[model samples]
Target: MSEIIRRDPRREWIARNRLHPDHASVLAALGVNRGGAAVSEWLGPHGVVRKNPHAIGFIGPNDVKRIDRSGFQQGGQSAATTPVAQDSRRTVTIDQPAFLVAVVPDLTGGRLSAHDKDLLGLARRVADADADQPGAVVAILFGEHKGEGDGELKEQALGDAGIDRVVHLNDEFYAGFAPEARLAALSAVEREMMPRFWLLPDSPLGGADLGRRLALRLGERAATGVWQVEADNEASLGWRCTARGGAGSLDIQRPLPRVALALAECAEPVDETRHAAEQLTLAASIPTTLSRIEDLGQVAVDPAGVALAEAEFILSGGNGVKEWGAFHHAAKVLGATEGASRVAVDDGFMARDRQVGATGTWVTARVYMAVGISGAIQHLQGIQRCDKVVAINLDPGCDIIKRADLAVIGDSTQILAALVTMVEQQRGGQRDAA
Candidate 1:
């Protein structure tokens, strides 16, 4: 019988490595057929591969031992037997030029707003693109300081959101949404840091007014409802925003020194991770020329409630709702904040603060129960961010019925009454079980 000869797969691999030691692993990993083309040509589409193979070689004694024991047959082959060189190393540095600053206003109840955190994340991305050094994400917090503990807590929260620095302007003048006072404080900061870009949330509070006023004061371009911001080139920055009338988006590129007002719910909030941030307390000198406006206390109403923008669950009323007392009662029973359509607010059926529509407050609620609402386009826009919309109206052909997740066709008062009873019964049952 003739002697049978078999080839070892490991030995074949070792032979290929000896022939093309640098590119053998890369060709195998990328599944590229190695013919006459050089390894540089093969890795063109992928990032540049340095000629020094030792830079990409395995490290440590354990790694070297593992590679040596992998059946890599090394005979008298000098090419494969040569050890990887360790001296030839390259260091790369990225150069960033400008700072991305996020201006966070104090929300009601002294708590940080969700939109503020989202703006911080967006600012971080912009800073990373434009800044070459560490401590690029800067936060400018304007609010009244309750105490040392509160100030420390707010600073810590900003640090947790990846803020590189916190400039807290805690003054009695910044207690309310006074435009002139805010403008003065912001102008001081602008003069000191001279940031490359400024980001402010497009809210009814100080955000919208302060952004525009500050931009005008600083003689920089201002863009509102800016959803996206990025570096256009090494010398310019680009801001993406929706055009008026909902036509399309517009990309506006400008050189350094610009301010952008971010729309509500535009960017998603990132996970909270603690980071070290330098905190600075600024001494704001309110300009003597800046006139102070007297703040009249808020007028008391029949059913005092949370702001429409901050409400979690809203029970909205429209022209179809006849009994205002019954509507308020139902909302109270269900633990829902009261909201009003334009017609209801105009007709004096509901408070102006409770209005929900394009001209009114935009509500982002977990559950929006529309009682007799017609679901006009303006109303739809206000509640567009609602997780679930439940509409109660008599007309089946109304827009609310078509767009609602759950539509009930009946008398608004009767449906609201029934819902209130059901919720109370569920609560009662839970209480009894507990």
Candidate 2:
């Protein structure tokens, strides 16, 4: 005869309600909230959980187990459940100083931003040179939630990129680009880690805004769009950046514990994948006053219309394009973000945000189509990272033509019109065939 089995009341209740029996019943039994401090306590000292008074729970070691679909054992001892040694626990203090800390904003699509990767590489180099002991490279990822699937991939990627520790502030408010919420979270981490140097990417929206705000709040000097950062001695750091539209370069020196904003394409990413970094989660209380600006929704744009620094393909214009409307149409047809030289912005043909040059936004597109741009030195600096440059200019001797991978000597208006027609006809043909 088969042995009789008794059903667990909590498990039965969870089943009747169509809930996950193991996960729900275990949490209910332990009186633990999904991502709350109670869960951390139940998991023991190895698990670090921050209490966010305003927002929901955060990403932590427990999240990794949950993502792996590995049910919790009654008395099973694993990394998630193992308690830290008393001696080791004493050494890991909240206020200990780290060599460098890189604040990485959670990017969309659960991938690390190119600029953030570069910042990490820079941090690794700085830490190696400037530290008294073997310094640590820490990365703080502020986002809404631990991404889907086993959160191992992201953690591993950061480790491979040379991050010794990753502090994730996973809250719904952090999921989107909430500057105020991120600032609060970062402030909390800063207080806890007390890092000597802070690195931030100089992206238009997130990094620059956060870096400036943090500097103002903390009363630290901030250097924006910095190309190089090096320790002047052990106490001061030096920053190098372009000044006056590539006409000159400025080098500024500031004391330690300063915030530095890294410019795009300043450093190459290092390829050193190591074991996954140690992970921590911070729970923070976002001020209601600060979070008054709620994000409504996002509007859809063509996939190619990404940020200038992040775009793979770009259609840029100069004064040579007679009609701005035709130029825009050509960009739309090519599925490219519209960019402009300084002269075009000066002529009011393009907005300041669309301008690409040394003084404006620096772009590293895979294919850059420059229509009628004469290509000044400043303009050339912006597209230096572009893989292929296609220039259409009436003058064969123009600076842009000389530098272009493929140069077409023609009228800008005629070339743009022809390209638009060609793209539209191709689309029409594909539709008919379909």
TM-score of each candidate structure, all chains considered together: 0.47, 0.46
Q: Model 1 over residues 1-434: C-alpha lDDT tens digits?
A: 76764444453444345366644664555544333233322223223332423322234444452123333443221112233454342221222435546565444345456677677777766665534453366667776433226657756655666667677766776666577777777777777777767888877755877788888998877777666554554555453444122333554434434677776565666454454457765565546445557766566443345667978788999999999999989988877889999999999988788899898999988789999999999999999988679999999999988879999999998888888899999999999999
Candidate 1 Cα lDDT to native: 0.67
Clashes of each: 2, 2
In terms of lDDT, the best-performing candidate is 2
Candidate 1's C-alpha runs over 4 A off are 1-102, 106-108, 130-132, 144-154, 234-257, 283-289, 302-434
lDDT of residue 34 for candidate 1: 39
Pull out the clashing pairs in model 2. 144-175, 160-273
lDDT of 2: 0.68
